[model samples]
Target: MYSWSCRFGLMMAAIFAVSSGQALAQTSAPPVKASLRLDWKGGGQHAPFYLARDRGYYKDEGIDLDIISGSGSSDVVKQVGSKAVEFGIADALVLVQAAEQRVPLTAIAAYYQRTPIVVLSPQSKPVTDPAQLTQGVKLGSKKGSATFQGLTALLAANDIPMQKVTLVDIGFGVQPLLVKQVDAMMGFSMNEPIEAESAGLPVTVMAIADHGVDAYGLMIVSNPDLIAKNPALVKGFLKATAHGLSDAAKDPAAAVAAVNNAVSESDPARETKVLDRTLPYFQSDDKEAHGAGWQSESRWEHTIAIAKKLGLVERDLSAHQVFSNDMLPH
Candidate 1:
């Protein structure tokens, strides 16, 4: 038999080997760093992303996401195309325009199923029909904005002459409407109507969709090169995002709270109300059938047709060239 000391020495060596192996197994790889560019300033519409970050959903997916604000949806497209950001949220119509310009961007997921563009007017003098907008009725809109393009498309598709209504360039904000600078304004269903109501100005909202303008709204976008080289990263980010959105849909209050906590400038009460109004746009018949962020081919065709009609795109780009469902989680 071996001496006791020799047996004890062997046992000690075994213990050390086991400890080292455990330590190696416990080591974790560093989280992948990625930046997400929002279409515009942070608001209730951005709650899902903030929810994901606040709840450590992104960390669970091995991604360290940096969510940044954007000047506009069109600018977000350019930012993603130039690789300034790995991903971006932008208007799907803008993506079509960008694709036509060969900007090298593709929409991976469509977040807003219904376009939020709307025509806001006082309840007292409600212009319910598109044709009701006539020569004397001044419509305020940011020149060259998606809302303006959407308004123009709605009028054109409905056989309403553009010259019948006057288009006034009113930068951002509802001051023009509140001050009666314009009889009506082109704004978002979730944005301006809420603000108007809060200010005790009852308004009638005419959704562009109700006027025959069928188009996709906000979409998750990325460059083709990113999808080609780091598909796993793209998949992980989308999976986490879908989970966050699912949870947000279940509890919008919690999602809004997450946004309020993450963003210093955010107003919790207002954002809570904003989120309530915004969530409906995130789901539709298509989303209910497939899942959230589902992009239907027919909808894309309609969007492309609208862009073409507006002369927003110079070349004809097929729906496939502008959007891809390949990156969405199964």
Candidate 2:
């Protein structure tokens, strides 16, 4: 027992045992087969999604959510609608648009309580008023983005014709404003603006929530057949998503750190700013009263009202046909 050789061997074995135990703990969870496609790249709005993966939130709820990047919200919705994917983090407006076309997808639960749409530009050439932008101001937005749709609604509401101004399809991010390609750009505030500001560019954001377009944002979507066949799975997804949002709200810096682990650490400061603004959407007066998940009555009615007024919907549809509160955890 007192021999140096024996002592050295025991010490090495103990070290190996501890290392092996840690490795097993980190790698023991079985891979789940769930597939989720996101319309946007990683950001604060995506923190809950990243949290669901990193913190074992989805796995704890018995789902192996395999979230992936997607081309756009329309693509995400189309894939989920076609049963090619189990879940999609997509715009709430896309569901309304799909229902208008009689597509058979349903929103199980919502993520952002407020839409993430925004008009990003430099403070020098800002679209301070939605109407003012059409006064020969150049604009940029993704071709089919929710914000682009809202931009149309905003112009209609303000009596500004779109053709009078420029509407360039700048893909994503704030390339137009940062590079001075366009006077203003419309996209996700928590995503593009935050990204632009972090990249050392002076950026100003006009969130649609602040711009009089307070529509519901990202929601969890699934095929209606899946909802009828396995409602429990949908409920679990919502509960986990809601829980992840709540946790992120309580400790956003740590939440961003968790997200940063999945993404990049170069922009933690900017990511936290976006998270702070985005968290309030998760808890509205209705959500506080109705528990978690999308509020079917008030929120849906407002969205439909806006869609109808903006001519985005042919006729008003019942909220029940589009969204359901039954999947939410009571």
Candidate 3:
């Protein structure tokens, strides 16, 4: 037999060769194809997905991700529930409503920790409180919207009768509010508020969450079929997505840059403002203590209760039935 040192050297070489081969195989394997549908057209709110795509986070998890712009959150929920796509980002309350209708959607991660709905009024003549919205106030309302649903919930919780204020129907523009056609309007804090401010119309924003109507906002959703059939893929996608969100939060400029690079029609300056306003809503007491995308059951239960009051859901739903924290990266 050969000396001990010679045998040990040969064994070491064999182990190195095996490990190298494994590493090469992993690097060379074709990435699995995946797609993500957004709640709306690409904007600053969606920068993390683009950032993830640009930084190869999905690729690192063997996922070839294609991000698709969508018409709306409800439409996205329908598409994902129908199994037309593997994943989607949508409003969490919308997901609960869909689930009540026997949709197969399950929220895998909480993207926004708080609702962004706000009552917008000109700062000169502000509607400071919900109680102030009584006296024949012409409240601009976009009916059949997620924010409208939130408005209804706020009214119910605060014991404000629907008849207390006159609902002025408006389209998806701030012109109605700017021209004093309506005293106040319901819109997202990030969208209409930013638009109004940019147009030199500073607004008095009353957040719904601050007025006893708290709820989880947008979330990452997937179907049970995908979650059951390919659990690893689900976990991998969440891991990559979480990393992308973390990176986006840390370097918003880079995130905006990545989004602009991907979408030719995107406006950088406007998107920058939107992203700046959006980043704060991503944090919560539970998120700070646990980690990103951590859902608190009590908070979710409260949201479901609000959905029930708004008649968005036909029946009661438990918080656990609509979401799962299994996929989030620890």
Candidate 4:
């Protein structure tokens, strides 16, 4: 056989070759950087994005996600359509409206299964039924807001004339309601009602969905160009989001903590409560079967019908124009 020195040299060379191969195998490509715009500022509703980022779900998907706060759902749609951002979360109806206007945005997933828009009034006034909102009742809402559009749809569905209720253009903040400036306010079920109750004002909440306005809530949207060009990126982002939402549903406390950690300005307890309230909106009998981020053609048709009723769209938009569930994680 071989001399001792030759044998040792051969063994050393084999060891070096294995070590180099291991190093090469351990090397990973840098993550792809991407941005995601939210419909509103950081809150409990945004826990999934934060949770995904904090838990390395995006990292696992090869995405370096930057979650950006947005002004409103409408604004988010505009941003995504303009390609100001690669992705966004917005109201489903807003996406319908945008698509009708040929905004070039496509919804990839439905994040909230049920609409969260509501009419908040003090218990003292107690406008429980949509029909109860009679003439001379002042309702506060921001002009050109998703809430206003939803309120309009609710009134129309209830056979109530828009002129019967006086519309007050109150920007943001519950001051208009707390100060009695407006008899009722248009708000989100998980937002303003909680604030009103905390401020020692017993509030009556009339969920728009309960009042005959059945529409999808928040949805994840992206530009058609992006979806067509970089489909892998879109699929990867959606996969990470699906994982994040699944984890959030399993442990809301962990999700809330992730939000609180990312947005220190938010009160952890309040965010926790918000996350708790938001979880149900993310699920439904249908979603339970198909999984989170699921979209239905029936829901899209309903939303389009409402948009047409509200005069938000001139022509009927097909479900294909508004949303595509193909990208959702299986």
Candidate 5:
């Protein structure tokens, strides 16, 4: 896959240089091609990228995005690190952990401002406190998955030892929770919760955000090599993506329609339900009131602190070594 770009950087830089009374001789910039992989399965959650493609935002920027579904968070990190694709969406915790283990990856944009991880249980025996999740309870989720890693982080943060609870693997889908095979399952705030709701299963969504575990969710990541070699391509991808995501939030119905065109998993009724349910997770211009997609400096520091606490990052790791938003779209 090639790095995508619109060849706009040189022109913009030339304008700035000329304004300073500098004799800037400009050469024709070559077109650049870039490929992108997002962590999705053609569901309502991926409406933004779908809208962006249908609206030709990616094409305008010379990006040939090949959207792919990664089953787990680590997979996304691995794929991006190996330069398999230009960018992929993955959880922040997993990325942090992988980076600590020497995996090369960096987040470019934040999808959900809040962490979507949760300790789910029946509405009756809701696992509200960290103390209630004891050894007797059978928790169901997947290993190397965002939910499992997030649960691990949550437990560590709350001082709830993992040995106290019986962790069970439940694979990708939400079947284990729905069948009463497990007391509670760690699931997405928007996705699995909606799946449970659609099946008439009574469940309480205890958002990780509610439990003092705030982190960025669904970030765009790229290889360090690609980032260094072709920053303009990365910036173009982010700008087009921001445009697409912004459009998706304002008109979810239209977003779903575009998603339906590419994927059979997306339809009018089912997808509309998913869109409405997942809408709460999205933060937009209307919600943020001039908020941008970049990570706040203070928030980044807090995230680093969490990583250090969990030993997921080097205690001495400088923030400069971990990330570079110099290529991010403004």
Candidate 6:
């Protein structure tokens, strides 16, 4: 029989061997290949994902992510819903609309807690209040767009009649406003206003959220099938994305630089300004407490209400049906 000391040493040796083996296995495992389709082409708001990609956050979480620029939020939702891509960044309204159509997708995280829709007018003739929109003001609107829908909802909530304001047909870009084609335009707070400023036209911005048109903005989405089958992977993706968002929040310039590095045509100066405007939408009381990527049930409900008001979704939808905070990092 062996001495007590000898048995103890053998037991320690076995434990060490098992621990080392586990570590080796973890380090040796291959990363899961994942693809993320963005709502639109690369822009300042998309910097965090590029930052995370370049900083190795996703790699640290065993995800080899490929970021793909998309045509629009609706396209991104369809791509994720069809399993054409592993994940996507899209507008919350589009996700709800897609869900109503029997799409197999759900919002995993909210990128912007508040809507980015705003009324933009040149400083020469600024629209200071949404109430002024009813006083024979010409408003630029893109028909069949979420912005137009939001504008109508904003007007109705403020007790302004749609017939009172003259809405002019306009395409994307700030030219319609800059050229005085319309008195003011309904556009994204982070996008057109910045573009107008860059072109030497200072403008007044009336945020729709401030006028009781609150709705969730862009969100990260994934199909329910993948989420059900590989919850761990979903959790890891969110954790790594949260890491990117935290880093971006701490050093926004660095995040913009990452975007510049990834997209060949990016303008750093303009993107820096875009990131500045976009950052404020990222925070809320819930995110401050629950951590990044947290989704509020009430906020989702409010979004559904807006979607219903706009006739974007016909079916009844509970807040929980479209989003979950389960995958967010604690």
Clashing pairs in 3: none
Model 5 ranges off by over 4 Å: 1-31, 134-138, 166-172, 284-290, 304-316
| Whole-model alpha-carbon lDDT for candidate 3 | 0.89
TM-score versus the correct structure, for each prediction: 0.91, 0.78, 0.92, 0.89, 0.78, 0.92
List where candidate 1 sits over 4 angstroms from the true fold: 1-27
Candidate 4, 1-330: lDDT as tens digits = 999999999999999999999887776668889999998898899999999999999989889999998988888988898899999999887887888789999889888888999999999888788876775678999988778988898988889888888889998778899999999999998898888887889999889998788899999999999999999899999999988888998989899999888875989888887888798898887778988788889888999999889887899779998988887778
Between 4 and 6, whose lDDT is larger? Answer: 6
Better model by lDDT: candidate 1 vs candidate 2 = 1
Q: What is the C-alpha RMSD of each candidate to the true structure, in Å?
A: 2.7, 9.0, 2.9, 2.8, 9.8, 3.1
- Residue runs of model 3 more than 4 Å from their true location after superposition: 1-23
Q: Give the Å error, residue 1, model 1.
A: 6.5
Determine the C-alpha RMSD for candidate 2 after optimal superposition of all C-alphas.
Answer: 9.0
Using lDDT, rank the candidates from best to worst.
6, 3, 4, 1, 2, 5
Q: In model 4, how large is the Cα lDDT of residue 21? A: 91
Instruction: Go through the candidates in order and give each one's C-alpha lDDT.
Output: 0.88, 0.77, 0.89, 0.88, 0.73, 0.89
lDDT for each residue of candidate 5 in 68-112, tens digit (9 for 90 to 100): 766766778878888877888777766777766778887766666
lDDT per residue (tens digit) for residues 63-127 in model 1: 99999988898789889999989999999888888888889888888888878999999999887
Superposed by TM-score, candidate 5 places the C-alpha of residue 171 at a distance from the truth, in angstroms, of: 4.1
Model 5, residue 267: distance off in Å is: 4.1
Model 5 TM-score, 2 decimals: 0.78
lDDT (Cα, 0-100) at 67 in candidate 3: 93
lDDT of 5 at 312: 68
